[model samples]
Target: MPFKKLHTNILERLERKDITTPTPFQSRSIPVIKSGANVFCAAPKDSGKTTTLILTTLHKLKCEAVGNAPRAVVLVENKEKALELYQAFLTYTKYNSLRVYVGYEELHIDIQKSEIFEGVDILISTPKTMNKLFLLNGVSTSQLKIFSIDDAGFLIQKSDSSAIISITQSIQKCQYVLYSEELHPKLKRFESYFMEHSKIIQI
Candidate 1:
C-alpha cells in the first residue's frame, strides 16, 4: 500500500518494469523510509532492499532533477557496487530529468569533481572516495536530501566506518538510510553521531 503513496513518476516506472508487488521487506520498510527519518534497514539479499532505496530516493526528490549538488548520495562498498547501483538507478531515471553520477577511486578525483560540477542529482560512490570529495570540496552537500548506503555490512571495517563518520560531519541535515543483511554493532554506533532519532527496520 505504501507504493500507492509514492510519486507518480516512480509508480509509472515500476509499472513499466513489471514490478507490481513489494517484497515483504519493502512492504514494511517503504512507508517508514517515506517518513523521512534516518533508518537502518536490515534484510537479507534479494529482499528488495536496493529497490526500496531507489524508489524512496526518487520519491523524496519528487522524481525530478533540481539544482546542482546531489540531492541523493548512495555509498557503496567498492567500485563494482557503486557502478552496479548506478546502473540500477538508471532504469528508474531513464525517463526522468534526474542525473545520476558514479565515482570510484579508479576514476580520477579531478574528473569526478568537474563532471559533478556540471550538475548531479543522485551520486553513487565509495565511502573513501566520498570522504575525499568532501575534503577537496569536490561535491557540495548543501542541497543533499537523502544519503543511503547499499550493502552497508562493509562498514564494519574501521576505515570504511571512519570514512562514513567523516563524511557525515560535513553534512548538516538529511535523511540517512543504511541497507545491510544484518545490523552489526558498529553500524549501531552511528546513532550517537548523525543518525539522531533514527528508526530501524529489520526483516
Candidate 2:
C-alpha cells in the first residue's frame, strides 16, 4: 500500500494505476521528504524514483496550498526527459489543480510572455532552457520550495554546474532532491552545493 502518510487522494489515483506497494527508494525517501529535508539519492533507472518524486512533490503542494508560479522545478537532461517527467507528473496529479510546464527549446519564444506561465506550479526543463526562462520569462521563483535534479551524473558530465547553481541560488529555504542512476566524481560538487549536511540514500 502507499504509505499511510501520503494523501488519500493520491493513493486512490495510484490504486487506479495498480500501484500498491512502495519501492524501497519510495519508502525510504518519502518520510525524509515529508520532513522537508534535502536528499541525494542513487538508484537504478526504472526503480520508481520518478514515482517517489511525483508523490512527494504533489503531496507537499497539496498540503501547503502554495500559490502558483512554478513552486517546484525539476531539471532533467533534455527535452525528451522533460516530456517523460511531465507525463508522469500528469498521471499522478490528474485530479489536482496543479499545472506543469515543459520548457524545451522547440517551444516558441512566446513563452517569454507571462500568459504562458499562468497557474504553472511545476516546471520541467533542461539547464539551458531554464536559464533562458529566467532571463526572458519575467517569472518570479521566490515562492519555489522544491528543486530537483533528476540526472545529476548526466548533468555533471555535461558541465551544467553553473546553470544549475543559478537556479538553485534564486530560490531560498526549499527542499532539494538529486537522483542519479550512477554516481561519478563530478557529482560531488553538485552534491555539496545543495545536499550539504543532508541525508544520502543509496540503492
Candidate 3:
C-alpha cells in the first residue's frame, strides 16, 4: 500500500518477496519517473535504485503495452551486472508476461550474430556488446522507451560510452534514467546531453 499507484500486478510480485514499503529513493524517484520524465537519481549503494528502475520501467511499458521489439535498454558496466539486473526485472515482470534478455560478451562470436536478442521487453547488456549487436544488425532501438544507465559513473568512464551514444541516437521516443552512487563532472556532462528537463533526485 505504501508504494501507491504502482500496478496491482507489480505489487503482487513484490508481495511475494514481502516488500511492502518503498525505499526512500524509490519513494522520491518513482513519482518523477511515473510522470514520464527523464530522471537523474543520486543514491547510495543498496538503496533500492535498481528495484525502483525495474518496477517503474515495467509500469511505464505496461501503460502502453509492447510488441516483440525491445522497449527498455539498460546499460551496465559488465555482464555480471547485466545478469543481476535481468533477474531483478524477472521479479517485477513475473506476472506481466514480458520477455527479458541479457547479452553475453563471450557469445559475441557464435551467437551474437543472431541469437543475442530474439525477443525482449527489457534488454540488459554491456555497452560494447550492444554496440557489436548493432554493428552486426542483431538488434535495433527503433522502438525503445526507456534508456537506463545504472552505475553511470563507471560506465561513462569507459570508451564504450561511444556505443551508448550511438544506441541512444537511434531511439525515437525514450525516457533516459541515469542512476549513480556518486556523480562526477564527466558523468554530469553525460546527464546534460542525455536528459532534457529531467528531475534530479538525491537520497
TM-score for all predictions?
0.99, 0.90, 0.90
Whole-model Cα lDDT of every candidate shown, in order:
0.94, 0.77, 0.78
Candidate 3: pairs in clash? none
**Top candidate by lDDT:** 1
Ranking by lDDT: 1, 3, 2
Pairwise TM-score winner, candidates 1 and 3: 1
Model 3: per-residue Cα lDDT over 2-116, one tens digit each? 3768877777788899988888888888888888898889999999988888888888777334676778888888888888888877767666677787886865444754553
Minimal lDDT window, size 10, model 3? 108-117
lDDT of 2: 0.77
Superposition TM-score, candidate 3 onto the true structure: 0.90
Give, for candidate 2, the lowest lDDT window spanning 10 residues: 108-117
Best by TM-score: 1
For all the candidates, what are their Cα RMSDs to the real structure? 0.6, 2.0, 2.1
lDDT of 2 by residue, 78-162 (tens): 8889899999888877777777878776776466345445667887888877877777755678778788888777676554778
Q: Candidate 3: list runs displaced more than 4 Å.
A: 63-65
Assess the local accuracy of residue 190 in candidate 3 as a C-alpha lDDT between 0 and 100: 65
